[model samples]
Target: MNKQNVTVNDLVQAATKFRDDRDWRQFHNPKDLAISLSLEASELLENFQWKDSAKSMEENEENIYEELADVLIYSLMLSDVLDVDLNEIVLNKLEKNARKYPVEKARGTEKKYTEL
Candidate 1:
């Protein structure tokens, strides 16, 4: 149950095995990975078209999970391609967001970034 070890290791192992077995990593450059990740996310969003939040959240979870896996898998591959530590990048981004969205400015509303 070591969080760091399991979280990233499992993802990396699975992605690595997938790439190796398919021999697809040769084309998974950083630019393509980033584009592909965004494309997968867009496809995920397509599943919930015109659905209410509560209804969509309750139904279609399997589809959502599948799309999310696509997005996340490519994300992991992108991280691998770039030699970036996923944990570190996530932590750093969170820190920056905390500063940018202090509770005083960001609480209790869906304000746009420019508004905040």
Candidate 2:
């Protein structure tokens, strides 16, 4: 399949199939999935720990890719288990963030929306 043509549903189906093939769904409850997602994210962060962003990417690019894929896979699995629409939720969040971080007040600033 073309990478560019892949959708969220495609990812979820692939992840579920892989899980089902391994009989891993029995352990993929929402809580465990959430924990796995966090663990994967922490592993991804480990690639950058004590290293500049450029240096980390240069030295750990392959590991970063794998760790990030793990994080995304767990996120997809969690969303599937919860029956949540990932695309819709992400879009809704983007809209909410746009409101919170309007250009007029948020432009060129690192401040939180509440502080803006």
Candidate 3:
């Protein structure tokens, strides 16, 4: 997606186009969308909050999916505001993290690079 010209003013236009294409606008007003995003985050947290890794791994698939979609939708709104390409940013961030998490010294721990 073209990221440079898509400003906050253009977000509604793009969002409207998306809604019109899929007939989803009835459910995507600013307030409703924000609330839905928060609720979805809570649901996602429900999967792992206060639970061991094994228990978190046992979470229901649909719950995780719904929460992820909610998060992504909000992320798209934020990306639209900043005119950023999320895919590009995410991939770059992953590469940076790989640099920080090399196996030689940073293996099997959650410490930050400074601590390592």
Candidate 4:
């Protein structure tokens, strides 16, 4: 599949197929998967640790991309294993957020919804 056209289902299928080929499903329970997801997120954040934003973005783009892929792979795996439809959930949350952060209140501010 073309990378630019890949869907969430494609990623989930590929990731799970890799796990299944290696007989790793036995070790992919929710707790461990969640831990791995958090670890990947931390690794993604590490690319910017103590670095100026522009310098970090310029110098660590490759590392950032790799870590982002790791994070998305794990998240896609988790959603698959849990039988959660990622697209539906994201859209649902967007609806909820729209109500909370109406554009009139959130357009320019970085404040939380409650503070807005």
Candidate 5:
């Protein structure tokens, strides 16, 4: 589905259905899901380990996509299990980040908000 057309609810529903089909929900508590998410993120990072961005992408594009998908799917599942609204939480975080890192202070810099 197109990015603009798909919603977080859609993703959560899809992930829930997949989990239910496999009877995997039994293993999907908040803690385990969080750990799975971290593991998937590390897998995604592995695509770039010891490689430049362009070369990593060129060599591992498919694996990168799959690992990233795993990360997102686990995140969706975890959010569903927690009964949290993903969009709401993400927007709330963005608002908080904006306050912490205003453009005037954060522009063109890689510094943390505290450093800025």
Candidate 6:
């Protein structure tokens, strides 16, 4: 499959197939999946630890992307197991954030909505 053409659903299907093919669903309870997701996120963060942004980006680009893909794949697996629509959930959260942080107040500001 072309990486550029892969979508969220495609990833979810691939993850599901991988799990099923290995009879791994028996071990993929929500809690375990969530833990894996968090662990991958920490790995992604570890790539940047003690390094400046430019250095991290330049020196560990491949590792960074690999960790990010791991995080996203685990997240998609969790979402599939939970029967959640990832894109819908993200869009809904974005809409809620837009209400909380209107462009006029949020633009060029780092403060929280209440602080603004």
What tens-digit string does per-residue lDDT give for candidate 5 at 1-116? 45678878988998899999999999999999999999999999999999999999999999999999999999999999999999999999999999999999999999999899
Best model number under lDDT: 2
- TM-score of each model, paired residue for residue: 0.85, 0.95, 0.55, 0.94, 0.95, 0.93
lDDT of 1 by residue, 12-110 (tens): 768878997999988988899899999999989987889986788788888899999899999889888888898999999999988888889899978
Give the deviation of candidate 3 from the true structure as CA RMSD: 7.3
Worst 10 residues of 5 by lDDT: 1-10
Model 5 bad stretches (over 4 Å): 1-4
- Tens digits of per-residue lDDT, candidate 2, 1-116, equal 56788999999999999999999989999999999999999999999999999999999999999999999999999999999999999999999999999999999999999999
* Candidates sorted by TM-score, best first: 2, 5, 4, 6, 1, 3
Candidate 1 vs 6: which has more TM-score: 6
| Cα TM-score of candidate 6 | 0.93
Cα lDDT tens digits, model 6, 9-68, are 988999899989999989988999999999999999998999998999999999999999
Better of 3 and 4 by TM-score: 4
Could you report the Cα RMSD, in angstroms, for every candidate shown?
2.7, 1.0, 7.3, 1.1, 1.4, 1.2
Please, what's the RMSD in Å of model 6?
1.2
lDDT of 4 by residue, 1-116 (tens): 67898887888899999889999989998889999999999999999999988888999999999999999988988998899998999999999999999999899899999998
Error of 5 at 85 (Å): 0.3
Selected candidate, larger lDDT, 3 vs 4: 4
